[model samples]
Target: MGKPAKNKEVKPKRNRITFETKAKIIKLKDEGKRNSELAKMFGYSTSTIATIYNAKSKAIVQRAVEECVPQGVCVFKTEYRPTVLNDLDTILYEWFKRNEGRKVALTMTALQCKARSIFAILMDPAHGIF
Candidate 1:
C-alpha cells in the first residue's frame, strides 16, 4: 500500500520594514495619500498602514530617520533583544539582499553556515568592531 501525500501550501517569508520606510510612509500620508493606497503601494494590509499612520510616535520615527542618516546608523526596532548582535543582523541582511538580487537560491542550511562564519569572523580579536 502506498502512503497518501500531505497537501500543504508554503508561504513566502515576511520581512520587517525599517524605520526609514516608516518615515517615508508617514511623509506620503501627510501628502494626502489614503491608507488603502499606501497599503497597496507598500504591499501591506490597510490596517497595517492605518496602524502606522495612527501610531503616536510618527514624529519620533521621522526624527530617528533624520538623526540616523548622517551618522550612518539605523533604528531597526523599537526594542532591542539582548541576545541579538546588531552588526550580525546588518551584515546578514545586506548579504541576503545582494544574493537575492542576483536571483540566488538560499536555504536554511546555507543561511546557518553563513551566520556561523560571520559570527566567528566578527568575534575575532582582530575585527575592528571590538
Candidate 2:
C-alpha cells in the first residue's frame, strides 16, 4: 500500500510592474487622473496605482527601471550590501570590461574560476585555504 501524497505548497507568482508603466502612472496622476481611472487604464487595482503614484522617492523608482532592477527591491537596499567584497568587485568589473572591449566572452564557469582565484589571492596569509 502507498502512503498518502503530501500536499505541496505553491507560492503565488509576483506581478512586477515595469518602471515605464510606473512613470506613466505618476504622470497621469500629475495630470489630475484619479486612482480609479489610472487603475482601469493600467489594468491594476486603485490601491496599486495609488501606491506607485505616492511613492516617497520617484527618482529611486526611475533609477531602478534604468538599471533593470525588479520593482519590489528597495533602492536603498540595492545601493549597498554589508558583506560586499569592495576590492574583488572592482577587480572583477575591470576584468569584465576589458574582456568585453577585446570582444572576448567568458562563460559562467570561467568567470566563477576567475573570481575564486582572485578571492583566494586576496585572502589573509594567516587564513589561507587548505
Cα-lDDT of candidate 1 = 0.76
Q: lDDT per prediction?
A: 0.76, 0.74
Give the candidate number with the greatest TM-score.
1
Off by over 4 Å in 1: 1-7, 56-78, 81-130
Best by lDDT: 1
Q: Native-vs-model 2 lDDT?
A: 0.74
**RMSD in angstroms, all models?**
9.0, 12.6
Please report, as a residue range, the 10-residue window in candidate 1 with the lowest summed lDDT: 75-84
* Cα lDDT tens digits for candidate 2, 1-130: 9999999999767676866788788888998999998888889989888789778276465665547754333446655332226667888889988998998878999889988887777664644367
- What TM-score quantifies how close candidate 2 is to the native fold? 0.40
lDDT of 1 by residue, 1-130 (tens): 9989989899868776667687889899999999989998999888888888788395586665666554323355554332336778889999999999999899999998998898888766677763
Per-model TM-score versus the true fold: 0.47, 0.40
Task: Score residue 58 of candidate 1 by CA lDDT.
Answer: 59
